[model samples]
Target chain A: MGKLYVIGIGPGSIENMTLRAKEAIEKSDIIVGYTKYVDLIKTLAKGKEIFSTGMKGEEERCKEALRLSKDNIVSIISTGDAGIYGMAGLILELKDGEDVEVIPGITASSAAASVLGAPIMHDNCNISLSDLMTPYELIKKRIEMAAEGDFVISLYNPKSKGRPHYLRESLETIKKYRAGNTPVAVVKHALRDGQDVKLFNLDSFDDSQVDMMCIVIIGNSQSYIKQGEFITPRGYKL
Target chain B: MGKLYVIGIGPGSIENMTLRAKEAIEKSDIIVGYTKYVDLIKTLAKGKEIFSTGMKGEEERCKEALRLSKDNIVSIISTGDAGIYGMAGLILELKDGEDVEVIPGITASSAAASVLGAPIMHDNCNISLSDLMTPYELIKKRIEMAAEGDFVISLYNPKSKGRPHYLRESLETIKKYRAGNTPVAVVKHALRDGQDVKLFNLDSFDDSQVDMMCIVIIGNSQSYIKQGEFITPRGYKL
Candidate 1:
């Protein structure tokens, strides 16, 4: 079997992609990813056997990558880091003895946090609100625990058409443990086209501003807004 | 004012760095970072002026970067992603007005995770074991809460000269909420020279194997070891 490289393309921005990700794509005989994510980098992977599918086609894509890797060098791509809510797990689970390499890239948490200043400078938790496969009760429990931990929390898949109220409900659980003045930032399409970033406090943030593409970050108790940018101090005495 | 690019060099590997990070360094007239981190990329910015300091010199570097950015393009570097336990927060806090662009890179959490398979493929929490800035009590609380949430826990700054037992104590807290057979990955200097990756059960992992340079990733409830690789499933049926 040939080598299989599971790569992270990094938030749809060409510059956000790591050198390793570019190199894997360059060395690959086949490139695979979700259609939208692949569309972001298809131009760069020209002359390769490109395989992409729409959302909910992860199993299909992972299987294809595994089959193609039997005799060909293949690169399976994911947006952001391939390990964090990406395709690495699925790909690894499906292939037993394939020589696979997981090339890490810039994750969405850091990408969104960087745009809204340094909101995640300290201990942080990333919880996805999408309950597609996970139960809603477990998701709520995770959010509650994260809030109780006083962690800088990054909420992934904040809002979706199927679960529009999940973000608000998650915030309500967070509000029970945090002060209303806690800083919150909702970033849509971070580092991608049609990017929208807005800052507000826990009580004042407009939930309607968020969507499936948005990432909402709520600050810890010590985090505060300075110079119109949200930041969590790393125990600095400045 | 000239642009201040606070860049993440990504786990000390040139290939792990993002294109934006490399570009910022290439465009910089002055480069600054912690001595260890600056040494990783000094050759890349050969013609540029460089300023680096030992540990506990963050405030001085941030101020210098700010002052220098007023006239010349300055790039302040950090190992891994600058936004996560790196230099971006301090730089944003010290500078009142400056064109600062935070270029994200692969954080150590993901870098270590990638080396040990997909241990953090689910909701995860990152808590530093170092008490130089954060109190040990708070760090312990964060670990307990993360365990209660069943998050794939990534313990950063796991061990140091001052507190060698912190990792064991933190694991004790996690053990209270998890099974002793929970998968764990101990990665030292991931993606850099002398990289060491090891796997063990939560009950069997040796404390002596860990240090401040190591990252310990504890798998969540749904995670397991397959084909000698740790993986947290993404709710896939197969």
Candidate 2:
């Protein structure tokens, strides 16, 4: 007879978390998530019954959270917005979603955009390069279409050990529509410890700097670098 | 010189705002924003110098915030994530992009997604139908491309008194790629007072249910409603 809460903890720091996200973690009897995400919020989860799993154990983690929610107030945490490539869907699917509440948080793209100076000030699309659950071909098609439409593109899970070539291929697909001078940026661990943000051009950005922990932003046709910050105008007359 | 903080307040409630956003408001000597957005956080702005403008006064508002920041710490508030179709770009443009801090908050799309279950649990695109700053042709093209890419599409500023036909026209564009039975949702004032979440079929949803304040989500081809919540699977083996 207890409720389940799927919480989006934003980026790592306690300061970046919403009041409700913190409240959800405080009010819960147990916490669950990927090991790294749980470690990120271990400060808030102090003294709470914690459950965690490795990278590929999302299914087991969600199922465990759902089972526990049947009897106790359990929280399943996902970094960034829980609904965006996060664990909200899995929890809602596993449990008939009877008593689940989703607490929204700042997404990685927005966090990166803030650091890069509003690179996504216009219409935008978020595409993940992880080919685990989604096919590479479908993700590539989305990249091409977003470029063709001139949408500000945010790339998540850009590269990992398993998918080494997907990020480069996705960039090649984007190069067809965007100019060589279009601004690109890599924000590693945005709002978290050791956050690093660097800007590059569409044709010259070094891919070696990107990894699974980074969120890459490729500006649209109108995006540019001004005073060292990547910016995209919202159809403003400059 | 004082610094300018462009803060996103999330949907509307203080509980939804990040700790950084709250800290920014508390540290600001003056607060500047649209009249309604400023009203949403007036409790925090109490006894502080508050300057607000009506709609269509964004340019004037940005200039005023910059002018005041020369001698006072200013926090310019946006209701959602400030970088997306928000005031971040305008402020960055008006100033020389110096000594400004951006505090990201939960965007309206994420807020709406939370209320609508997990409708955007996959790759997605956010498009605004407002043509005041952007040309109608460009907005329409983005809609077509997002639909063609099979992305979960989120529409903001869907309808206004002046742009009454844009939402319907945009829906028609989406219908060409998405099936008529694809799940769609309209979330009005998400996370705020008078919040409403409604799910409908792509072909049957009423356009009158949407307005400038509502965020409409058109699910991808694979989306469906379950347990009365609009749910989109993340390629999980159901």
- Model-by-model DockQ, in order: 0.90, 0.90
**For residues B1-238, could you state the per-residue lDDT of candidate 1 as single tens digits?**
6889999899998889999899889989999988888888867978779888999899999999999999999999999889999999999888778889988989999999899888898899999988999988899889999999999999888999888888889888889988989998899999999999988888897888788889999999888999888999999888
Model 2 C-alpha lDDT versus the unseen true structure: 0.91
- Candidate 1 residue pairs in clash (backbone atoms < 3 Å): none
Off by over 4 Å in 1: none
Which digits, one per residue and each the tens of the lDDT, describe model 2 over residues A145-230?
99999999999999998888888888888898988999989999999999999888977878898998899999999888888988
Find the 10 residues in a row with the least total lDDT in model 2 chain B. Answer: B93-102
- State each candidate's chain A TM-score: 0.97, 0.97
Model 1: per-residue Cα lDDT over A85-179, one tens digit each: 99999998998678899999889999998898899999999999999889999999999999999999999988888998888888999999999
lDDT (0 to 1) per candidate? 0.91, 0.91
